[model samples]
Target: MATQTSIPASHDRDFYAWALESANRLRAGNLAGLDLQRIAEEIEGMGRAEKHALASHLKILILHLLKWRYQPTLRSLSWQLSIANARDEIAELLEDSPSLTGKLPEILARRYPAARQGAILETGLPAATFPTGCPLTVEQLLDPEYWT
Candidate 1:
């Protein structure tokens, strides 16, 4: 059995130390000494981080698709590579957290506007050049062979 330290690690002051100590307590079955509230919050934070990662990758894929469709003259291997990479990342995230598949519609709805604005900014094209909303479905956005 691991002995508890006289004082608990401060979560805010030193997060790495707190995490290590928490892990030690858990390994030792010292539930009474565990910081349950902060541990729960940290676990929830991890889930939110995964969700944000999915949204970010979705935005990148959508932005590249918009660029590919609206600015064919400006297309480069960089854009194609980015689109491919985003699809791979999204696939990995879904594999790791299958429940996140249910969140795709919400993620797309929230990320598409940002992606559209990004396309306008990155391409210096008029906002009118891009559609007001995403024209593609999640399936199309993630399709490895779907190039517009």
Candidate 2:
């Protein structure tokens, strides 16, 4: 049982304690004491955070791939490791949330410009060197062996 005074007091002072307290309350059938509003929002935020993480990893992976393709002479182990790591992370994310697969095409299209600009800064290549649109499809981007 949670200390009576610790219930509300711990919530504002220490988040971990608050979470533990909340779990205790929930498991003990003390729904009346839960901060359901905050818990609901946090749960919602978790989904959005996963989506954002997927998009971010894809962006970096695509950027490095553009650099790899456009600046072949400048390629190094770092880029190879980045692409491989990103692919692994993306695969793990998809394995956990297969539903997000449908969103990949949109995410790739939306994030391509950022990837292109990132490539420009890293490669010092003219912006015009990269196509105005993404050159690779989501399938191509995710393929481990597809290095152009």
Against the reference, the lDDT scores of all candidates come to 0.93, 0.89
The candidate scoring highest on TM-score is 1
Model 1, 24-80: lDDT tens per residue?
A: 989899999677988999999999999999999999999999999999998999999
Cα RMSD to the true fold for all candidates: 3.4, 2.9
How far off is residue 85 in model 2, in Å?
0.6
Residue-wise lDDT of candidate 2 within 3-105, one digit each (tens)?
6553364556887877777877888999995789987886788788888989999999999999999999999999999999999999899899888889999
Leading candidate by lDDT: 1
Candidate 1: list runs displaced more than 4 Å.
1-7
Instruction: Quantify how close model 2 is to the true structure by its C-alpha RMSD in Å.
Output: 2.9
Candidate 1 overall lDDT versus native: 0.93
* Clashes per candidate, residues 3 or more apart or on different chains: 0, 0
> Mind sharing the TM-score for model 2?
0.88
